[model samples]
Target: MKLTRRLFVGASAASAASLSAPMVMGQARPRVVVVGGGSGGATAARYIAKDSQGAIDVTLVEPSREYYTCYFSNLYLGGFRELDSLAHGYGTLASEYGINVVHDWAVGVDREARTVSLAGGATLPYDRLILSPGIDFVDGAVPGWDLSAQDVMPHAYKAGTQTALLKAQVQAMPEGGVFAMVAPPNPYRCPPGPYERVSMVAHMLKANNPTAKILIVDPKESFSKQGLFEEGWQKHYTGMIDRIGPDFGATNVEVRPDTMEVLIDGVAEKVDVCNVIPAQKAGRICELAGITDGNWAPVIPHTMQSRIDENIHVLGDASAQGDMPKSGFSANSQAKVAAMAVRGALTGSQVFPARFSNTCWSLIATDDGVKVGASYEATDEKIASVEGFVSQTGEDAALRKQTYEESIGWYNGIVADMFG
Candidate 1:
């Protein structure tokens, strides 16, 4: 189902007709505009398309022709998965799911008008809007690091061009050269992602260049799944990775791309490759729409609707929901509940009480895996943890295999649910 503009227009018109027919019969389906098409937005689109059964018109505004999953990206870097495997086309959303997928960046939201303005000069009017635009990196947090330096050092966090750039650098690096990774502080997207990426890169370096080194500069003293990752690095990469916590005098580093040098504690060092995952906040649209305060948009739990704007709902890594880590899985789960809430709001129906779940798997060494997850519920305007766990310590061979298998299963299910 490759959806061209013609197909999209036809589906949009058909959906509109279905919803409008109710008006002639003295009833009408509501309209919804989704501001993104990533994991969270896409899942919301899917559920809305299904649960509404053409009674809701959904328009998904996104800039990309395809959506990429960050879950299996580490495997893609480790030479175990291909880029296409993690990529998903929006054909299903446009054609089969009856979602109007628009390939344009949403620029503004007129809450009073109930409309979203896109960069392409399109104004989409909606009865309710669901926003899931992902996080944007905080520029200048590293003093000299900014968008101009992205060519030399890509965050690779968004899972497309940046991912390819980092992969090519690793493949082309000289033997035994240093690869520096600056991990972002907490309250960031995918807590275990950066470390898992380092582990996978180290896995590649071990087989290709045994003497190569990886320097992980961190501002925090502890990280998610730290103990498991450290043990796995010791057993597998064996001193190839140097862990630098804030205590290691790396707190005030500045990056200079012209010379490919990073100044750590006033001392400059050159590296063959650099992956700088900087601090992050809600995407700019959130702030522009008046939904965000400082870093993220405050939202009512269970509903995910903006506390300040009743007509708009925010989810994914963009919302300031307590007790929820910013992972793809969490985003996907929130999307479902958000879609339901948006529909209920627009149609004057009941918004069911919802609980959210998330699990993130980190590949520490080749074939070794670890994870952390939680189930959350809303209580008195705040989200509280229900149940979850970090991966068990002292893994058995059988458990390791099971974890790996479960990781793969999660990847497949999530991608399928998002695209199919």
Candidate 2:
């Protein structure tokens, strides 16, 4: 219905005639295969397919039929939103944008051949490949925390099975029971997520179990929106929340799932509910492809093209780009830049300089919210910040309410832009 100046300029500069008309006239199209249909992959697939206008064959490979976004998953836990509202289908990606949506996981990547091997045994060849498979948990980073133990201690970090598992456990907890959450170390997916989750779940507990308490065991001494979240927790939960940072003996905690207990500094405590968000790395697909080091794949800042393999680009939690946190907004923004770069590369054009934006919102209660954000631009060769942005800290009632409402609007607009 409307267009921003940036979008208009991007559209004009990336017209079909400018990028793909030659191939169409020659009766051939360059193939671009994208792995992972989350924020990064979906946005790139849609934009490139739309811009190419039949001159670029876009194939998207993902395992899930429907995507569940983690951005507002906390609202679902608080009973403020339905899960169906967060689930988006890829039909529009196929029918409207002409993207070939393949519901399958990519098991192997052949960089030499420029082909991606699917778990279903199908091979999709591409001139350029984009991978945004998200994060994978580092198993057993915390002693006694593993796959089977996840049944008793759900992470709920990845937003699918984990989300459902945690919700069920929270619903079953008795009134006045303890709900303990172990926040992961820094540089984890959705930096403000675990705190937001505690807030939403605490809201539910306050309504149904006024005596319930939330124990947050965090690896770091401080976190994003710490003051804002603490203020909201105090205002709404009446000090029912307790936070133990690393300095306060959080790192010394160990999980004992067999007994449904967590030990802080060797003092075992049983809880009715337990959620452990462990350390994470690039999703297994990147590891299988041998494109990542430690927990992330290194890539060029503006282009997002893999430094290990120039033809491949990685985004989302899977990439270790400088100074960028692993959040949905970051992934989505990087996807746009990566897509433009891919198109430019395919058509022998120059990649433009780009800026990116990210904002994370956390609800402290039904009508109160906290947030942090930043506007970033490329600096010479690295991604750097252009402005400082954060929500009002320390007990502002009206601003909190405004941020809560704004969070809803932001969620609606982001999902629509990605899937609609």
Candidate 3:
């Protein structure tokens, strides 16, 4: 249902009037402010606004006009999809859902005052604040490399221009040259991401520069879907890829972007292109709000409410909600739970026990895909996994193609769910 400002006030007045003190006292409509515009934030904003049916005022603060999903960005790098295909806009939320989409950076959060200060000098007041600001690289996570060197060695973890830059570099690699990736440690976004990227890069190189070599320096001893990734790498891009795990001094690594080189165990190897995915923390805004415990904001699994501050809710990679891997599917699932909680709190809507699920899919080669997924339930302490599944090592060829198709369908479904 499309709602104008007038309808928002009228439809919400009764519910807002009935709200208890300290929340919506004398307020015609309960205000919800959502920061960030990725999978988690966009889903929460759209769900709350659509489900509330004009009974709540929702404001979304995001600096970027076009949001690109980090989930399928690897497909873009591999030539399976275009970067533009991953982009979504906020026009529908503003026009159809009556959401106040503020294109500005939320720089500060005054929890005591219940206000968010935007970089554009506007303060957004809210009864409840939702923060899903994805991730920021940890300083010194990669020695001799920083944001200043991103132009030379792209992380491309956040997608968009960085993704395009990385792809361009890969395409321009000289024949038989090296493509090096310094993978992140444990508890990073998209557990299978770096490996999927390697697969994609290998896919491209196999077709364009057949003799090119791919190098991976990973800190973790074991990664998600290691067996499957290893199997596929061997089957499709054998002799073209090499991985240095923790046993091989992958933990002690550094990069020289200016010289286009990676040093492992004090031994430097020259490379044509480098993709350095550094250790990450919750976005800087979470730190500004004083809501982060260490690197992430802890949240109540049942409602996705911040453990540090009850009035705030944290979602996606920014929240240290247990068990669930940091992926787009996980964030989208958490958003539904948080949206229900926010609606129940502000508009007297029905609330149910939170159930979450996530599936991470990776394409190792054209029509050759693998996945790992799990169902989750909210416990007092955390979101615990209930059951899990993974694509088997010896799955049939047709099934792998089906799995890749499923991922494409998921991509379409999720973008529609998040934006529309």
| Per-residue alpha-carbon lDDT of candidate 3 for residues 147-227, written as tens digits (9 for 90 to 100) | 999999999999899999999999999989999999999788999999999999999999999999999999998999999
Give candidate 2's total backbone clashes.
0
- Model 2, position 138, has a per-residue lDDT of 91
TM-score of each: 0.93, 0.92, 0.96
Best model number under lDDT: 3
- Per model, how many backbone clashes are there? 1, 0, 0
Q: lDDT scores for all predictions?
A: 0.84, 0.84, 0.93
Best by TM-score: 3
Model 3: residues >4 Å from true position, as ranges?
A: 1-23
lDDT tens readout by residue for model 2, 1-420: 588653453355346545444453343567889999989999999878776665577899989999999889888899998888889999988867767899998999888988899989999988889999998889777888987787789888877777888988998899889999988997899988898899889988888888998999888978888888887787788878998888778999899888888888888888999999999999998888788987889888978988899989998899988777899999999999998998887765557888899988888887777788888986646678788788776646788789889988988888877886
The whole-model C-alpha lDDT of candidate 3 against the native structure comes to: 0.93
Candidate 2 residues lying further than 4 Å off, grouped into runs, are 1-27
What RMSD, rounded to one decimal, does every model reach?
3.2, 5.4, 2.5
**lDDT by residue (tens digit), candidate 1, 326-346:** 888988999988888876665
